[model samples]
Target: MFLLKTLTILVAIVVIIGAVTLASKKAVHHDGLEIEDLNKRYRMMANAVKQAVMKKEAWKKEAKAEKIRAKGDDRSDTKPIAFVIDFKGDLKASAAASLREEVSTVLEVARPDDKVVVRLENYGGVVHEHGLAASQLSRVRER
Candidate 1:
């Protein structure tokens, strides 16, 4: 009888302790703006963390790839690398011609070995003017 009574008391104590723990668990609430701000902050933090992880993983993969490539490179010789430039435009006031200075600056940096591939796609303008513009690009190619 004493053991039974003691067991009952112990069970009651355990139940009360469990109830207290459950009751003590806290919940959070916020107003709309506060919730929105919190969500924005969380998104920013999550994005930062994601970017950091991605950078770390990318560096690891790049290092591993470089190591593999270096191993193979020992048996090969470096060849001259080539580049091709693809120019495109439309016959509008906002065409590449408006940026001639900027484009010239880019062309000035090009090595003589570089090849340029111009694609003419102007469909809206003085139709004959596009022909003249394309001819100028051909002049650049000859040079």
Candidate 2:
């Protein structure tokens, strides 16, 4: 009976540890903003510029010119977009998975004129890890 009780205790401990381990594991997070959102942000900035110009009485006439410039002559065409991704590599290059997912997401909606910029920081680590990171970046170039 003592042996059975010990085994039951051991199983219970193992189950508790397993549950804690799973709970502690971090989930990967990925997010991106669309170009249209960026354009809206730019428009807001332009409006702010107009507001500043209005405050300066001397620049009142220039305010109209500024507004016309801010509206941009190219309004008839879609502005080219750029997607930026930042990666910090460790010895395991675990960020490669996230990079791949982000790149794939961007590619789905990216136009031929769009750009992808990956800002990477690495102190150099395992060869395979770096290679995997490079491969992930190459996928961006392929698109």
Candidate 3:
């Protein structure tokens, strides 16, 4: 669309220049002020057209992303055959709660034959927090 718009603008500018040169029969010289004015106006219009086309493309992409997000909200009873768990956080009580919730959600949606992969990264904090997180990953393996 942008390409077509740009080409159209370019063609319009060419036609405008041709008409201006033909109309100013007595002063069609290159050094004439009217020619310069026509060139400036053409450039300005082309730039404006380009900017508007870019804005339209951006809006289209945003709308497409919104549609995908809306579609993803629908849930089905069938569980996925494979799953992955991403565990990356400091070893704190707050982090532990977040990790626990993520694990529990995965387990709920995961099928019996599904597999979970946890990427553990620990920054020393409460010992119990890390212990609980390790236990969560171990539970995945036990199943």
What is the alpha-carbon lDDT for the whole of candidate 2? 0.76
| Tens digits of lDDT, candidate 1, 1-143 | 99999999999999999988877764443322111334446756865676577778875786677568657865332433232333455655245453343335436755565544444455576656566565556555665
lDDT per residue (tens digit) for residues 16-37 in model 2: 9998888777453335533346
lDDT of 3 at 43: 54
1 or 2, greater by TM-score: 2
Clashes of each: 0, 0, 0
Q: In candidate 1, how many Å is residue 4 off?
A: 65
Q: Top TM-score: which candidate number? A: 2
List per-prediction Cα lDDT, in the order shown: 0.55, 0.76, 0.68
The stretch of ten residues in a row with the least summed lDDT in candidate 1 is 28-37
Per-residue lDDT of model 3, residues 1-143, tens digit only: 99999999999999999999888995754431111334446756865676576687775686577568758966565644545455666646456666677777778877786767676666688887778877787777777
Q: Please give the lDDT score at residue 10 for candidate 1.
A: 100
